[model samples]
Structures are given as C-alpha cells and as structure tokens.
Target: MKKIYILILSLILLSSCKEKLTEEQIIVNQNKKTIDSLTYIRHNLHPEYLKSDNSELVANEIIKNCFSVLEIDRKNLEAVKDLAHFNFEIKNYKEAVHYYTILIDLKDDLNNRYVTFYYFQRGLAKFHLQDFNGAIQDLQQYKNENTDKRTIGYSKACYYLGTCYKNINDQSNACDNFRTYAENVATDEAWNLVAGYCN
Candidate 1:
C-alpha cells in the first residue's frame, strides 16, 4: 500500500512539472513576440530609421501577441482592441482587420462594447482603402446591431452607407442614405458630405 501511494505521488509530481513547463513556454513565447512587435513598430515610426520594410513582420508579431494574450487574459479586450487601432493608424489594414475580427468574435466572451466602436472604425478604414464591398458589409452590420437611436452611431452609419453607394454610382441609394443621415445627425461634416456628393 505504501509503494502504491508513493507511485501516485510521483505521477502527480510529473504532471505538475509538465504543466509548469508548458506555462513557462507560453510565457516566454508571448514575451518574445511582444518584443518583436514593439521593436518593429519603433523602427517604422522612428525618424532616423525611415526605410524599414517591416509591416508584414510587425503585423504577424502583433497578431500573435494579441491572440496569445487574449487566450490567457480575455478581460484585456480593451488593450487588444487598442493594439488593433494602433495597427490601423499606421495603415496596416490587414492587421487591423485581423485584430478587429478577433475582438468581434470575442465580444460575447469578453462581454464588452468594443466591437461596436470597431465596427465603425474598421468600416472607415475599409472605405478609405477602397474596399467598398467590405466597407458596406461592415457598415451595414453595425447599423443592424446598434440600437441606440438617440446617439450618433445610427446617423454615421447612414452617412457611410450613402458614401459607399455614391462611390459605386448608386445615386438613388446614395440620396436615400444621405437623407437619413441628414435627418438624424444634422452635423456639419455629415451635411457637407451629403451636399458635396449627393444630387
């Protein structure tokens, strides 16, 4: 009986060591990826470094870090979302898309409103990149989900949808959307976009 007890204790110790090793490996890998991302971003933004072609490298590192951190600490959705936005600011649209996609996927898991804002932000980026199909897709998704009738989101969606239609020469649809935006927002920017583009 004593020998059997000792055997069980040995097995427990072995399993614990394996778990610790796995956790340590994960931590080390995440740190390395994060360091790589930070270094890439710094070089890209540094005035003296001017000629780096590391956008793909930086994007990969950020996506890896964001995904790994998310697996461990999903409560850090805000941090992950911000990192995604940082990608967008640098015109790293693919990276931005990846991050936002993950963020939206984890919305129920994180129980956060991040996806709402990202919907709009990603829409704008897609629009500027002339991914008109993608822009319309995201904008329409946002408009469908956002039920805040008293806020500005509804109106912005209308304006963006109008812009998307106008870009594609769907003037009739553009006019309808512009009318909706003008009715809801009444802001200078929204009004100007409508006036300049709509017939």
Candidate 2:
C-alpha cells in the first residue's frame, strides 16, 4: 500500500513538472532607428556595386573592421571574403587578389558555391591587372564548377571569356564565346560583339 502511494505521488510530480507551451509573441516599434556605421557601410557597398566612392575614409573604416575581426579569428571566412571585396571595391586589385587567393585556399564548412565565386572574382581582378592567361584559367574553372547554368553570373562569365579572348587576339574563340553570351543575355554589347567578331 505504501509503495503504491509513493508511485502515485511520483507520477503526479512528473506530470506537474512538464513544461507548458506558449504562443509566440512579437513586438513592433514604429520609430525609425539610427543607422550604425556597419549598416551604412554595407548599404554604400551596394547600388553601384562598390565601383566608386570607395576610396573615402568611411570605406576604409569597414576594411579596418574586417581586419580587426580577422585579428581575433584568423580563419574567419566572412572577414577574409569582406577584405577581398573591400579591396576590389577600392580598385586595389593586387590586395584583392591576395585576399581572394587566401579565401580560395582556406578550408571551410560552407558549400562550394561561394568558393566558385571567389574564382570569378579573382579572375576579374586578374583581368584588371591584364593577366589574361591567369584570368582565363580562373574564369574557366568557375564555369566548369558551377552547376547552375541560367544565372546572371553564367552570362557574365561568357561575356568575360569573349572579352579575354578578344584581348589576346584569339579571334575564333572570341567569336564562339560572344555568340554564347549573345544567345543567352541578348544584351546590346553582346550583340555588338557577335556582329563585330562572329561572321
């Protein structure tokens, strides 16, 4: 009788201890909040794709933050990628290539999609440096590794391949790639290249 009573008491205690579920609660504020420095920097990085006005002091501050983050965590991939992009945005192609090379070399838990883009970015940097052979290699590798064929990136890659070939005076390959770009994106520039290069 005593054991039965104790077992019943334990069952009641366990049931009482069970957690109760509650509905999610959300709070909304109508006031406009002040923009922080990082937010401002990120916003500015877009629009023009960071193609201009990036040599200013405010832009340098973001680069400094990326470096500061890396100082604490050397293998921080986001910081490394940000550094690469910031340098590129500022037209510091040499530094962009350096950091992008590091990004390519560093191992991470992320899917390879971002890594593939690093190759494309590095290729563009090499192109800016007029290293046509190196740019061709990187851009080709990116094209091969990428699984999605219909994105804007693929179109840009095709366009760049044609430009690279044109730069090197490889007329046949330039015609082939420009036609490919024209068929997919149908941009005025691509059509012009096809007309000018491909008979």
Candidate 3:
C-alpha cells in the first residue's frame, strides 16, 4: 500500500508538471506563429512586391493568414484594417463590411480625417451588400463630417447615398443627394443620374 501511494503521488506530480509545460508551450507556439505570419506578410505583401503579377494571389493569401491571426487575436487593428482594405480592393464587399464593422467597433481613435474615410468605405461596402438603409446612415454620417466637397470621396459618397435612397424608395432624399452629387462632379454619369432620378 505504501509503494502504491508513492507511485500515485509521483504520477500526479508528473502530470501537473506536464500540464504546466504544455500551457507554456502553447503560449510560445502562439507567439512564434504571430511572428512568422507578420514576417510572411511583410515579405509577400509589401508595397514593392504588390506590383508583381502574382500580387492579387499574394494579397488573397495574406488576407487568409491575417484572418486566422485575427481569430486568435481579434483586437489586432492592423490585421483588421489589412483584412478590410484587401477585401475592399478585391471587391469582396461582404468581407469588407464584416472587417470594417469589426474595425469600427474596436477602433479607439475616431477624431481624425480617416474616420470619414472609414465611414465612406463601410458605407460603400454596405451598399454592395444591399443594406441600403445602413449604407445611407453611414454615408450620411460621412457627408455630415466631410466638408471638402471637391474630394472624390465626397462625390462618391453623394452618388452612393443617392443610389441607396432611391433603392429604399426615398425619392425626395434621393433627388437631393443626386443634385448634390451632380453639383460636385460634372461627369456625364452624375448628370444622367440626376436627370433620371432627380427629375
């Protein structure tokens, strides 16, 4: 009985030690994976390498890898922004909306000019996703804050806002936004939209 007790106690000690080692190893492995992923992105998705023929493929891979990392660490804003931008660039509007939504909620600093840009991009994503009301809200928010009417962003926002309003049967608001867009951008498309929708 004494020998059996000693063996059991020793087994328990070894088990506890193994558990501790396993926990430490898990953390170390996670850190190593993060480092490896960041390094891979730096090499494969850098601006210099992005001009290559395989840039789109490389960007898709990076987005996949970044999403995995983001799953482990959702608060990584860089990963979130990268996912949002890459998805937008690839015209994966659904994924762009997902990441931008996450980024908007997680982002701490919203006082800069970039805040309007984020709203505009997210609005466009929502527009592509067919969430017209949500798109209107986001685009309107951006329009309210962005004072530079000469910017391409402002024109796009107005155009999309008009589109969103028209889709939702808000013809009055649609006409108003279409007029604003036409006033800011003297393009044939803008004028045609204003004529067709605003009249």
Candidate 4:
C-alpha cells in the first residue's frame, strides 16, 4: 500500500510538469506562426510595386496586412522599419513619424547605426509635418552620434538642420550647418540652401 501511494504521487508530479511543458510549447508555436506570416508578407510586398495604378490596391492590402502583424508583434523591427519607409515613400509623413518613433523608443535592442537612421528619417518626417523644433532635435542627435561625415545621410542631416534653424530665425547656426553641408556635398538642393540662406 505504501509503495502504491508513492508511485501515484510521482506520476501526478510528472503529469503536471508535462502539462506545463505543453502550455509553453503552444505559446512558442503561436509566436512562430506570427513571425512566419510576417516574413511572408515582407518578402512578397515590395514598396516599388506600389507605384503602378494596377498594383496600388494590392500594395495597400499588403500594407494593411503588415500593420496587422505589427499590431500583434510590436517588437518586429524589420516590419516596423519597412512600414516606416513605405509610409515615407507614400508621403504619409505623420505615419512615418509614428513608426519611426516606435523604432526610436526601442533603443536597448537596436544597433547605433539603425538608431541614427531612425532619427534621421523621423526628423525628415517631422520636418515635413512642420514640427521644426522636433526635427532639429532628432537631426542633431543623428549628427552628434554619426561619425562618418562623408555619407549622404550626414550631408542631408546638415542641410535639414540648417533649414530648420533658418526657419526658426537662427541664421548663425543655419549658416554654420549649411556651410558644412555645402563643403561636403554638392547637390542642387544643398547649393540652393547655400545661395538662399547660408550666403
């Protein structure tokens, strides 16, 4: 009788452990399915294909699907960034700012380079939305963190920072950044800023 009671207790403990493992496995499988669906959408939905009238509807549907996935899994960085870029391409600057803000808030897990890109893009979106001071803060953060002054991003940040300052009537800082941008990049836009504001 004693031996039987001990055996029954051991079996009960084993069964409880197995139930816990099954619950964990179910959660893992659900997460995997969500990730897999997101991956499929990302692979199939190129923003370039959205330009044509014929494909615009399909592209919008794909964007909706991406949004759905993002709603469920907010930490999916690639999908978030893709959505941000897509919004920016479509001239939805406010939406781009929203998505980029999400990415910016995830500072702990992201690389510095990616964080800088987020700041740059978000700053551009904010500028388009007429939030000049917000734009300046993000653009300045990118400039301070990014070491490579030769990249197009650096020049663009400088140009925009200069423009933001000019808009706010800060000619001194405006000319300073615009001059730096002109010295490094010779784009038509940069030259226009130099002629119009920096001079």
Best by TM-score: 4
Off by over 4 Å in 2: 1-55
After best superposition, candidate 4 residue 15: deviation in angstroms? 13
lDDT of 4 by residue, 1-199 (tens): 9999999999999999999999999987877777777678666656436555645555565567677666668777877887788788777899899999988889888887898899999999999998999999999999998999988899889889998999999999899899889889877877787788656
Candidate 1 per-residue C-alpha lDDT over 86-137 given as tens digits, one digit per residue, 9 for 90 to 100 = 6786777776777788777787875546577778777877887888778888
Per-prediction TM-score to the true structure, in the order listed: 0.60, 0.71, 0.75, 0.76
The local lDDT score (0 to 100) that residue 21 gets in candidate 3 is: 100
Number of colliding residue pairs in each model: 0, 0, 0, 0
Ranking by lDDT: 4, 3, 2, 1
**What pairs collide in candidate 4?**
none
C-alpha root-mean-square deviation, candidate 4:
3.7
Candidate models: Cα lDDT each: 0.73, 0.76, 0.83, 0.84
- Candidate with more favorable, higher lDDT: 2 or 3: 3
Which whole-number lDDT from 0 to 100 does residue 156 have in model 2?
A: 83
Off by over 4 Å in 4: 1-34, 47-59, 187-192
Q: Residue 122 in model 1: shift from native, Å?
A: 1.8
Q: Across residues 40-134, which tens digit of lDDT does each residue of candidate 3 receive?
A: 78665767445878767877877887877767776777778888988887889998988888767754655557767888999998998899999
Cα error of candidate 1 at position 194, Å: 4.0
Candidate 2 on 1-199: residue-level lDDT in tens? 9999999999987766652211111111111111233345466654444455544454567787667555546776766777798788778899999999998886376568888999999999999999988988988888899888777887788788889999999989878878878988977877887987777
